[model samples]
Target: MPKLLITGIAGGLGRLVAKMARSRWEVIGVDRDPWPSAPDGVVVHQFDMRKRRFEDVFRTERPEAVVHLAFVRHFRSDPATRHEINVEGTKHLLEHCAEYGVRQLVVVSSSYVYGALANNARYMNEEHPLNASRTFPEIRDLCEVEGLVGTFLWRYPEIATSILRPVNTLGHSVHNAIGNYMKIQMVPTVMGFNPMMQFMHAEDLAEAVNVALEKKVRGVYNVAGPGAVPLKRALEEIGRPYFSIPDTVAHTLINTLFSLGIYRFPPGAIDFIKYPCTISDKRFRQATGFRARHTLAEIFASVAP
Candidate 1:
């Protein structure tokens, strides 16, 4: 079996991907956090990707492929370190991949990169420009990482790089912004704005990654679950009661609470509830014949409090 290295193997989605990939590839895991419950055959190392010891894994193990999942998602702490791990860490990772001759790379990005805009297409394609920072500037590092990976994809076609922009992910283990928001009591909504949303189970996303790696999918593609739903419907499906308010009041209250460490997401996240940022996964589905297996009901069930 070819060797595959998974960064952020301690994470929920990362662990799932590792389990799914282990059958076909000898899996090596890397993360700053420890994974004591790692699968029997997999060897996990605790190493910060931005540090010197991280490169040692590549030099020693020489993985044939890599799944880049190491990122600071919640952005509530040390902004500087978060930037280093997300943006600067990716820079070094790309350099290492090039130097180490890794044959394939799979980067898991978020559909939020498309940005929730009032004028957004019902379903954005890969060609759509990433303008997420226009409102949600907090995730600029994610955009920067994707930009770096996007450039690397073209600059090193021999590497067979693929970037997946998956919709909001929710599961029993993963804690994404959407999941955190929906899990809260009395979730807030922008008045008269019921944006469409796309959600997928973390397991389905893990399978998507497996298919991309298996088929060596190259280029950027959007990944989605079976269907899209209105924000109201999504909240209802998850048994989350949301109260609608004017955008001004909603943003202010959320930001204030966030500053006091009461809210999980930033104020800019209001745009997502106010505007749709759904994406079409036709390109990915066409390229690898990958279909999300989890139903919307299952996806919501995993996030229900």
Candidate 2:
């Protein structure tokens, strides 16, 4: 069986992908934390992605494919630490993938890279400019990571590099800013701004990765679920009570709360609730012949209290 290496394998998405890919490949997982119970037939490595020892895993496993998902998403993490992990760690991973002759590299990115702006198109596509850093400096590392991977894809045609930019991913096991925000008893929103948002189930995303590896779908693809829903409607569907506050007051409150460690989302995330950054998955669907099997209601139910 071909060897497959997955970073962040301890994460919900990574574990799901490992389980799905196990039937086809021998799986090796690397993460910063140890798993209480790792998946069957998968080797697990616990360590920092930035450590030079990471390359040793590449030498030992000699994986034919790699799925990179070790990015830090917590707002409380030091910005410098996040950057070192997201950007520099990715750089190291890409370098080692090239050196080790890895045939396929799948990098998971977020739709937030498009930047939530008042003037954004109704449905941004893959060619859309990544302006996320213009407002959210914390995500700058992610944008840079995409850039580095894009350059690597062009410079190294031998490696089938597939980049997936997925929208708000929701699932019972998944822990993300949007999921945490939705699970709150009382959620917050910007006054008079109920932006349209799209969500993808973690299972669908894992399937997309599997398809990419199986089909060698090269280039950037935007992976989205069935449909879009207004922020308020999403809250209502999840049975969460949310009140809107003026944008200025919301920003200030979020900033203060984030600084005090009372809130998990940063102030920059306010724009996501204030504007639409919905993405089109036409390219991804066409390339992999994959469609999300879960409905919007199912997605909402996954995170419901």
Candidate 3:
């Protein structure tokens, strides 16, 4: 079997992707977090990707394919630390892939890269500029990482580099910003605005990654779930009640909560609920024939409290 190296294999989404890959490839994983007693055929190395030792994995394992998922997305750590882990860490990984003769690379980016601006299109495409950092500078690391990967895609045409910007991901295990925001008690929203939001089941995302690797897809694409729903409807589907605050005071209020560690999302993210950042997966679906199988109910249940 061909060797496949999966970064962030300790994560829930990583495990799901790894589960789907082990049967087809010799799966090797590297993560700063430990996955004790990993299953057979999946060798998980525990360490930071930025560490000098990471290069050794690429040199020794020489994986033909690579799946990048090692971002510090949950925001549990400090911003400086997250930036180093996400942006700087990915720089090392890309260098390793180019130096180690890897043939394929799949970068799991986010649809949120196209900021939830008031002027955003109904279903933005891959060509849409990434403005996420314009307002939500807190998550600029993600945008920067995507930019780096996109540039690498063009620089190293020899490697089949695929960048998948999946919409908000929801699952029982995987932790995402949207999922975290939805899990809040009395999920807060700015009054007079209920933006259309897109979500994909965790398993569906794992399958998307599988298709990208199996097809050796190159270039950028957006991945979506069954469809879009209003922010209120998503909460209603999950049986979670939400409260609306005046838009005037929403930012300050949310910012205070975030500083106090009571809110999962920061004030900059409040604009998401106010504006639409929904995406079109036409390019991805047309290329890969991948249709998300999970229903809205199934997606909501995964994140239900």
TM-score of each: 0.97, 0.98, 0.96
- Stretch of 10 with least lDDT, candidate 1: 260-269
* The candidate that achieves the highest TM-score relative to the unseen native structure: 2
Model 3 ranges off by over 4 Å: 257-264
Ranking by lDDT: 2, 3, 1
lDDT of 2 by residue, 73-147 (tens): 877787788888899999999999999989999999999999999999989999999989998877888899999
What's model 2's lDDT at 302?
94
Winner on TM-score (2 vs 3): 2
User: How much does each candidate deviate from the true structure in C-alpha RMSD?
Assistant: 1.3, 1.1, 1.4
Error of 2 at 163 (Å): 0.8
Where model 1 places Cα greater than 4 Å from the true spot, the runs are 258-264
**Candidate 2 weakest ten by summed lDDT:** 261-270
**Which pairs of residues collide in candidate 1?**
none
**Tens-digit lDDT string for candidate 3 (33-121):** 88886779899989888888899999999999999998888666777999999999999899999999999999998898899999999
Clashes of 3: 0
Looking at model 3, the pairs that clash are: none
